[model samples]
Target: MSNPYSEQLSRLMAEYRETQRAMVEAQQRLRSLSVTETAPRRVVSVTVGHGGRVEDIKFPTAAYKRMPPTELASALLDAIAAAQRRAVDEAAEVMAPHMPAGVDARALLSGDVEASSFEVPQSGVSDILRDLMSDPGK
Candidate 1:
């Protein structure tokens, strides 16, 4: 007779394979993602990848000629920041469904979601310790 658990095992295997395939596809999409943003006056455009690496920048030569160097630098930085934000937002969207419940995918990417970073306030800890020391019998 066939094993009773065989059917469940087969179904689970299929689901695992599907999840792997989906992860691969999502990774490819993220790698190929490029967010382009323009400055307030459309004087500069910046393109950044999903990892926030600068991929390209474009500013008209005529505009550059008339713009102050400080303004140009600020515009470049603003455009890059805008593009990075867009990339992070898109990555968060893509990663959310795959992440565990209650996990912030964006925070994890920024190295801010680690469990070790969680801390109880020192004052709270001290209060608890004081209470324990004062009421050892309880």
Candidate 2:
């Protein structure tokens, strides 16, 4: 018996190589992706990398001078959040094909609780609202 398991070993090795190739391709695709988001009123724009790092921010000085500080702050927050969300979605897409069947890759990557899964047994609107509005430290 000259390496009786040679065939099986060869097949496994091929599969391992294929998986590595796919991983490299996916990494390249992810690295090339950049999420660009704009603030309200087109006052500011931000480009975020795959890891949610801000790569660039652009806005005309006039635009900044026109908007109030509070509005500008809100716009910055919104744009940054949008960029982060895009990164999460793109990463999910890249990882989805490699994930097992029936597994939600996006949800797994984001670690976000689905709103529809919330259960308030026998709780009325008033009760739920009160609870939500209440102080969390109590």
What is every candidate's alpha-carbon RMSD to the true fold?
Answer: 12.1, 17.2
User: Which candidate's lDDT is highest?
Assistant: 1
Q: Per-residue alpha-carbon lDDT of model 2 for 29-135, expressed as tens digits? A: 88887999888678888889877788988884458777789988888888988988888899889988976565676787677646355454553445544654684
Off by over 4 Å in 2: 1-4, 113-138
Please provide, for model 1 over 1-138, each residue's C-alpha lDDT reduced to its tens digit, 9 standing for 90 to 100. 764345545765797799999899889989988999988767888999979999999874457667889988988998898899889889888888887666788887766778566453444435545665797664
The global Cα lDDT (0 to 1) of model 2 is 0.76
lDDT of each: 0.80, 0.76
In candidate 2 the C-alpha lDDT for residue 55 amounts to 91
Q: Give candidate 2's TM-score.
A: 0.73
Error of 1 at 57 (Å): 0.3
